[model samples]
Target: MVQQMVQGSVDKMKAELVAYIDKKFEIAALTSDSSGASNTEETEDSDPITLSMIMLQIAAIFEKFGHYDEIYRTYGIEADAFQDECNEVLDLMRYQVEQVESQLKDFQNRLHIEESGGESAVRHNAEMQEKFEILSKDVQESISQFDQYIDTQLKQFEDMPQLLERLQQELASKQGKSESLVRLQEHKSEMIAKIKAAVEELNLQLPKVVSAQIEKALKD
Candidate 1:
């Protein structure tokens, strides 16, 4: 195994890799199922880029590492871990999606009973206002975290491509990790697509869900 290492070193490179993974945590796969070009432009806080872009960025990260198994032991990055990360993000989207769906359902249920300008409607509007304000705040925080994630990925994939290439090139000569890299890329894509559809629904509903701003639009 030592003979397989490049001429200059093994221990130093291993240490460097260990340090890098420690610092990076992992280039996690943030999953989302299929979405139909959801309008992400409505929110000032949401990233302009599509969620699909964010989910697919894992491909760029996989290209950085040479030994897939070694990286897994050294860092908790593998197909299963990547899927778990994807599911975790999906959970967040599901939460907001469910919330909006419930709110909309309740709004419909009360539509005929409550007079358009009556006290019951006013109270229901106030109730929805409060619920959505809380939901909006939580979603904003999630969006911020995702934006940070995107920035993190952008930095990692772009930061040191040359050095990364040198490492992969040298290591691939003996390890033939190119095949492993391809498998990981396919795994990421499969898992990440599962959550995009829910996120798209959430994105489509959120603005209209929160259209009433307590006083300004509540009168209607």
Candidate 2:
């Protein structure tokens, strides 16, 4: 009876974690959709409030996972095996929080750049692409860590690969949009085509890179 109760609690916690993650993704999709609607103006900056909300949700996930870890320990079920995995996941979550905070700060800086006027728009777009690249790298690293952990702990969670692919696609779309915006400042049509092609190639390569990393993680 005690074992059954413990198992029930564990299942409940897992369900809650899954629900929370789903909600996080939902919020992210909503944010992207809202941004797409507003981005038609070309003058509006990315919403800091939306980013802050995502960060807050991430923090909550971290905290909830910590609590779940403690509960797992109390149940005395593979707690030792999970210790390193839990620690690594928490570290990744903390790193992601830092990344989100950095993004928020960068967005504010971009706003200031916008206010400065003139060719700053082109410069701003370039900086935005650079920021996205950094963020993409950070996300790839986090996903790699989690992919490894998932392999060892929950092999049934096949959605991770799809999730990673979706994230990479979103990042690529943002990069492409930024590049196009920057190209608007250039008078040479040839240069714009070349730049767009280069960025598109990079975007095509990025998913493969992320996929390779996840595959390597699973193997290790």
Candidate 3:
């Protein structure tokens, strides 16, 4: 675009320069110092003025052309070098713009992927939070039930130990007077074994329940 604008200005300057040259030629041909009376005065003043005008026109043409660099190198004065420099710079700029546009397009595609990934992450986080909340509630409920069962079983086991102690004491105190003491001692031992079995059952179940809770927590 800059090249085109520079070319257009050069063409316009060329046209104007041609017109100025024609006008100068015509004026010189018509109004000359031919009679010798005005000749000295015209030579002294008019020729210089015409030369100055031509020089000014040439300078203006160079300025319009905008090739200052080459003009300085070739003629030691700025001339039509402006157009050539502008064309070179503009071509380079066009290539840079194309590269930038391609990079911008690639960035846009990456931005879309990042946005989509962000959205997916949001959804996944929400789902995980929901699952965590549900699992936490279930775990809490299960733990409460387990605690209640443990409390009840503990109370029962405590009572059994006290009963065993009392029965042992009774059998020892009535050892000689009561023949039934032996049978009572045997019954007490059986009762103790049954209590131990019940305690073992609860111990085995408690660990399983805790492990299940841990697995559930992991899933969530």
What TM-score does prediction 2 earn?
0.20
* TM-score of every prediction relative to native: 0.24, 0.20, 0.36
The lDDT of each candidate is 0.55, 0.63, 0.74
Task: Give the winner by lDDT.
Answer: 3
lDDT string, candidate 3, 36-62, tens digits: 766566556555337788788888887
- Poorest lDDT segment (10 consecutive residues) of candidate 1: 25-34
lDDT of 2: 0.63
Off by over 4 Å in 1: 1-113, 164-220
147, model 3: CA deviation in Å?
0.6
Worst window of 10 by summed lDDT in candidate 3 = 70-79
lDDT of 1 by residue, 1-220 (tens): 3223422244555565565544333322111222334333223224334446544544443443345435545554455687798999999999999999999999987875565558877888899998778766766665665566556544643534574565456556655577757755564565455346545655665454444333333353
**CA RMSD for every model?**
53.9, 48.5, 13.5
Error of 2 at 16 (Å): 36
Candidate maximizing TM-score:
3
Ranking by lDDT: 3, 2, 1
How would you encode candidate 2's per-residue C-alpha lDDT over 1-220 as one tens digit per residue?
3455556656666676567667667655566666655544432433323567656766765676666556656766665556778999999999999999999999999988777785877788898888667666766796776556545444433555674565556656775776645544342454456557656755575577677765654444
The segments of candidate 2 whose C-alpha lies over 4 angstroms from its true place after superposition are 1-77, 118-220
Ranking by TM-score: 3, 1, 2
